[model samples]
Each structure stands twice: as C-alpha cells, then as structure tokens.
Target: MLSIALLGLLVVSAAASPSAIKDRTGRVVHKRTTEIVQLYAYGTNISGLPIYAGSDNLAYLATDDAASNFTAVTWTIDTTGTDAWTVSANTTAATNSSTLSSGSTFYVVTDSSSDDSFAQAGFVSDASDAPSGATTTGIVTYGPYVMILEDTDDKDTYVSEFWATQSDTDGVWTLMWNEAGTAQDNSVPVTLKTTAPVV
Candidate 1:
C-alpha cells in the first residue's frame, strides 16, 4: 500500500540527507538522482509559489507550510518526437521516479516519503505517447515554463491551478482531497525545487 502511495503523485522531489544509496549487496550507487521539477502556480493572488503535496492530501505552497521543512516532488518531462507524455514513475526504487505526460492533468496528494510523506499520480497515460525516461538530476532553475494542467476527473476541461495562504485547522494552507467533484480552481503546480533556497 505504501509503495503504491510513493508512486501516486504525478510529480515529485526530495530532501536527501546525504545518505549513500546502496544496492542489495550494499554497494553505494553513484548514479544521479531524479531531476526535480518545480511547480510554480499562477493564480490571481499567488504566483511563482512552490506547490507541495500536503499532509491533508491536497496541494499547498511553501507559503502554506512555513516550517514543515517541505520538499516538493522531482520529475522528468519526456520530449519525444510526438507531443505526448506518460505518468509512469518507473524509475528504479533507488530513484523512485517515473514518466509523466507533457501536458496532462494530474493531482497532488500527501505521501510517506521522508521528502514530505506525500505523492500524487493522478494523470492518465494516452495510447499515442512514447515511453518516458529518467536521466537528469540537481536543481532545475531556468523554466517557469507553462506545463499546462488538466482536470483529473475530466481531462477535456482545463483549469487554472493555484495555491492559497488560507489556513485550515492547524493553520497549514493546502489545497487537496480524496473525493472528486467540480470546483473553480482544480489544477495547480508544484514548482521550482532547491534543497537550499537562498537565505
């Protein structure tokens, strides 16, 4: 159940503790980790805020979680000849990453990764898309690019994804859930990953 949860998020990131990743025989692997994708949401009130899978099972920005030591999901967008993408986090358990579509609709949810204990893989793969790959690592800082979002329930209708500073009971501001329905702001982004943000 937990492993499936880890592979649920459409995207992902991590806050590694310099722990050497070893194989079955305990030999330290030297491969690069998953290339982290930063999801910067653009809303009427919020723009460029990092979106993360919240403890409440919704998407929240860094402004929402001021002290949880939050780290968003890491991902790699496949740009094969055709304009198609897949949401299969088939990367080795060492990386635990997968392939997601270029412009598909996905949902973010809380998982159990030490990175944040949350993951959301709600995007659906199309038949025409090609296989995705995982080969990049480190902080990706050049793109505030628009990775258009779609609704998890209805991929036909597009939605503007964003996060709010509005707090719930514990004062953590997150936008997510379990059940599905119609809402205004359905699609949001989890952006711009940097383990050590400028201080």
Candidate 2:
C-alpha cells in the first residue's frame, strides 16, 4: 500500500509540472500568443484653476449675454500638483458670485440657463473684501490689494478675464488656466488647491 501511495504522489506532481514538447529532431518546440488592446478617451470640458494666497476678496464680471447662458459656479484646490481640483455645482440661476476660502477659489460656467453645463477657471487671490454685485463694468477691490475687472459683449469670444497679485507670504503659489477649448461660450473664475507645476 505504501508503494502504491508513493506512485500516486509522483503522478500528481508530474501532471502539475510545465508541459513541454520535443520536435522530431530532438529539438524543443514552444508556442506563444500575443494580444492587442485598445484604449478609450473621453471628453472633459470643465476644469478648475489653481489656488494662491494674498488678499481676501472675491469678485466677478459677466457680459449682458452671459446672463442668458451662465449659471451657478464654484471653486476647488489641487494638493497633488496634478492640476486637478474638486467642484461643487450650483443648480440655481439666482446666484452668480461666491466668497472663496483662504486656500481655495473656484467658478462654474454653464450652457443651459438651467445652470447645468458648468466650466471652471483658475484662481487669482484670497482677498475677502472683493466686490459683489451684478454689473457689466466696474472695478472691485478686496483685501490685500487684488482687483477684478470684467468687460463682456456679444462679439467677444472671452466673456471674462481674471488677475491677482502673487502671494507675499510664499512666492510658490501661481495661477493656472484651463487647457480645454471653448466648446461652450463661457469662463468662470475659481480657486483650486493644486500641486501641479506652475504654468
């Protein structure tokens, strides 16, 4: 019985070993197969900007036509330096401006008047005293010397442009713009916490 058991073990071990074949000339033969894979790419039209420290203000400007398609907006920060930030969408058409946090800023632009199609821009300053009102033209000053000037019209492609002073505390902070093209006619300002190299 012990000899029979040992023989069964040997048979099991041989079956588990890698299989091999020999050619007619006593040479080894091997078979191999290759597989091809295809990757898919999707469209991302919305993105947020980088966050910088300086003043404590929030301001924005919109054109007359912006009132038709623009909707609720928000901001985010990128801690991974990957130029990615979180976004919070506002579904209501009643509000257009938002007060940002000390380390973050963000904005959203939409296609439908329902305030659904939103796009995000980069941050400028952390000024809290920035102006807040619905106006076609004006200069609003927030804390620490940051200003927002908005000029928009039916003929222009860019509906807004934002600028902020570099932070005095840490010169490391910088502004970043969205790489996505203007699929929809809108640009909203926002602040994102990002570690992405300054661009």
Candidate 3:
C-alpha cells in the first residue's frame, strides 16, 4: 500500500509539469513565461503612522482608503524589460527632505543594502489652531522588502508621481524619501535601499 501511494504521488507530480502537456498533433506545448515580477512585504503601524524599518528593498505606495489604515497590507511591484526603474520621491538631492502634510501622500524606495527611514518631520500645522498629527495606518512589508505610506491623500498622486520618477531614471535609478524639518515625537529609523534591475 505504501509503495502504491508513493507511485501515485510521483505520477501526479510528473503530470503537473508544463512539459506534460501535449497537443492533438502529438507535439509538446510549452508554457509562456510571466512578463511581470511581483514583490510583497507586510508590517504594522505605530501610533497611527506606518513604518517599514527593516532589512529589504521594498518601496511604499501612498493610499487614501480610511478603512485600510494601520492594518496589514500587500503591495505589488510589476516590472519587465530592464533592471532599472524611474520613480520619484518627495525628497530630492537638493531639498533632500520635505514635510508630509496632514492629508498628503508620499512614497519611499529602498535598496538591497543600507538602512531606510520613512517618518514624519512634525505635526501638520494649521495657523488658526493647534498643530495636527497625521492619522494614518498600514504595513511596511518584507520578503525582498516594501515600505507603505498610509494617509488620506490622493492615490493617483502617488501613482502618477511614481511614473514620473521612472521617466527620469529610464535605465538606472535611485529613490529617496527622507523627511526634513522637526522630528516627530515617535519617529523611528530603519534600513534603506535603492531599487535597480535585479541584474
């Protein structure tokens, strides 16, 4: 009985192979390769802020869904053709830092090596009232790596800006999203990385 079960399992595994398929003409059919490679990462939020402070090359996507705040999230990365991607970060080489307003969106991309930090510089200011803290939630993930920026900002803004960044670095690229100005009360730092083709 054991021998029979083992034999059956072997047969099933063999049949699952792509080469096992055949056409009516008695020719073997090959499976087409997937064009896009997707990467994923997940983490928890602290005090309404989402942080991705670990070892991985994941980038964060900014979103505006209120119900999705401060929860586990799955982010996807689709790429083909070349190893490098062109994308933008709110912080640049010149400014090298910026403030994430109370209801704004931003992104952070890290490399395979180095520490990455994604944090708010200070509470969003309102001239007529007290400073407003950013109330957002979601996960920054891992595997290869991922960082998620949570807020009630426009999702399209982040997507469009990412496309623009890709346009800037058509072949090779680096992403930066460091916060500048006054550091918040609960700011935590982590590893950062630059994303290029996996070449």
Indicate which candidate wins on TM-score.
Answer: 1
Q: Model 2 — TM-score against the truth? A: 0.20
True lDDT of residue 149, candidate 3: 34
The sequence of per-residue lDDT tens digits that candidate 1 reaches over residues 1-199 is 8877776542232323233555696544444433335454444444455554433223455454362533344344332111322222323322212343333333333223232322332343443231131111111222344322332553423222222434443433454321232242433333332332333
- Where does the lowest 10-residue lDDT sum fall in candidate 3? 156-165
Compared with the true structure, all predictions reach lDDT values of 0.35, 0.29, 0.28
Q: List model 2 lDDT by residue over 1-199, tens digit each.
A: 9999999999888656443455586533333211111111111221222232212222222322332322333433232112323233334434434443333333222123433333223333332321231121122222211123333442312222232222232222123222232233332333222122223
What ranking of all candidate models by TM-score puts the best one first?
1, 2, 3
Q: Ranking by lDDT, best first?
A: 1, 2, 3
Q: Which candidate ranks first by lDDT, i.e. highest? A: 1
- For all predicted structures, in order, the TM-scores are 0.32, 0.20, 0.19
TM-score of 3: 0.19
Question: What's the residue-level lDDT of 141 in candidate 3?
Answer: 27
Model 1's lDDT to the true fold? 0.35
Comparing 2 with 3 on TM-score, the higher-scoring candidate is 2
Enumerate clash totals for all models, in the order shown: 27, 26, 23
